[model samples]
Target: MAISDVPPADCPPWLVPVHTLLLGIGVLCWDATYILMTRRALATKSYGMPLLALAVNLSWEMVYVFYVCEAVLETTGFFVWLLLDIGLVYTTIRFGPHDWKDSSPWVGRNIGCILGLLTAVGCVGHYTFAVWWLAEPGRGIGGDKRGKWWQGREGLDTTELAFWSAGLSQLNLSAGSVAMLLVRGHSGGTGYAIWFFRTMGTLFGLILDNAFMWWYWPAGYGFIVSPFAVFIWGTSMACDIVYPFLLWQVRRTELLLPDGRLVRCDSQPASTASSDHGKKKR
Candidate 1:
């Protein structure tokens, strides 16, 4: 019997809790990020995260909560995220258009509608891909992505799929939101709280990556270096590393408007920086 075939009750207590702690905490940080993003959008009437990333994340949560195996700790986390993501979806559709309002109100609404529909399409695609990947045998992986090392019981590897898709989504999110902050050249909706939650997500992401690689990599297979693992985790870590630095650069440029709103430093009048600096020196 393959390790994937191992029943939930048979899983070691220590393993389930540890896995849940690492994965769940990281997920929570991401949830918080989304919540803040939602608030930022409502307050500033601007979008925070890329709709593509948001859509993908919502799909991931939906999949795990509904279709994936029901491990107590893991499924519980997914269930919570599923509930939280509904609000995120609403926020995405609500605020995504305002960013494009200068073009036309219709344009903004169109963009929102398009992204929401595409996200729905993306959910179906994500589910199909996960199901297909899970169906493949967990044979010894080689440099090639699919290895035919063994023919074990047919089953789904939920953890592996989550890391590949959902985890990868998170990796994109860290960098994507920061990129939005830079491009808009404003911190109106995105502030320290957004960055703070993102940082927590990134930190916990690294922990989960390390934990999975060290503890669960190719349980029976002899050191299978799957391409999905390499690409997903590898790319994620690279982006995660750069996220903090981008955040700091964004912070340096933040300014407080006379109306008591915060935006990127460049958005304000030139005197804003000097006045703030002078105040600091006082």
Candidate 2:
């Protein structure tokens, strides 16, 4: 049989405790770092949209983790997580920065705005479908052949919702990263490191989740393996830990421009000279 046919094992011995520890520790670190960095940024007057973007992202991340661990898997958890997810998508789309004026008209602000709005709409639709499913447990829709909502069976409708949410989340994240990078220009320094790790963690979690689904397909009982679930817990913790360090660095550095954009420095001579001239003119 295919790997998808494999049965899931029991929850791994180290999974729950380790993940719990990581999640808790990460949140504490994230909180401490956020407060410290925010104060520093304000004191230095270097605060800008990027800081706001980071705050929104990290805040939603924390909430997402909380719901995942305490809410999503349970009956009420699903609704809670659904609402939080919707909030995240909306914030990312609405508050996340975009730099259209600097780019070609074809790939400029309008396009990015459209994409962001579409993504938000998609997320809302997915959540709406999920809410509907929850409201009417046995309504035939999508892959829900059995019409049982609480059993967590992967039906067409539920699967579609998962697929859409996952895809939209990725899109939202990518767009936000690109917007930040563009607004900040080249001097992002360790900011790039923060983005890199965050992106990697997200991608890693997604891969593990998809893998678990595949492995648990057919007659398999592999839900116990739960590699994705564990990865998410661990990644969430890592995000919390790294968030503070990155935010601290950002606050310490004079990285915001006068126009309220985050400044990025170029390393190469030509680009550096160009940036220097631009800074001087500004």
TM-scores for every candidate against the unseen true structure: 0.72, 0.39
True-structure RMSD for candidate 1: 5.7
Query: Across residues 1-282, which tens digit of lDDT does each residue of candidate 2 receive?
Result: 011111235434443334334333433333333333333334323322242343334333333343222233322423443343343334333333333334444434344355455445544555465566545433432221332123343321333233334433444444444444445443222243444444454433344443444343422222223455445444444554455444544445434454443443432236544564334211
Per-model lDDT: 0.58, 0.38
The CA lDDT at 181 in model 1 is: 65
In TM-score terms, candidate 2 sits at 0.39
In lDDT terms, which candidate is top?
Answer: 1
lDDT, residue 125, candidate 2: 55
In candidate 1, what are the lDDT values of residues 1-282, reduced to their tens digit? Answer: 112333234345455445446655676887787688778766765567766777777777777667764546556766777676666667666766655554367757687677768678868987898677766655223311232221343433444455456655766676677667667655555667777777667566544543553354344222324455556556656765665676667656665455434555444556766575421110
Query: Candidate 1: misplaced stretches above 4 Å?
Result: 1-13, 102-107, 139-155, 202-228, 254-282
- Give the residue spans of candidate 2 off by over 4 A: 1-126, 132-163, 179-184, 187-192, 216-282
Q: How close is candidate 1 to the true structure, as a TM-score?
A: 0.72
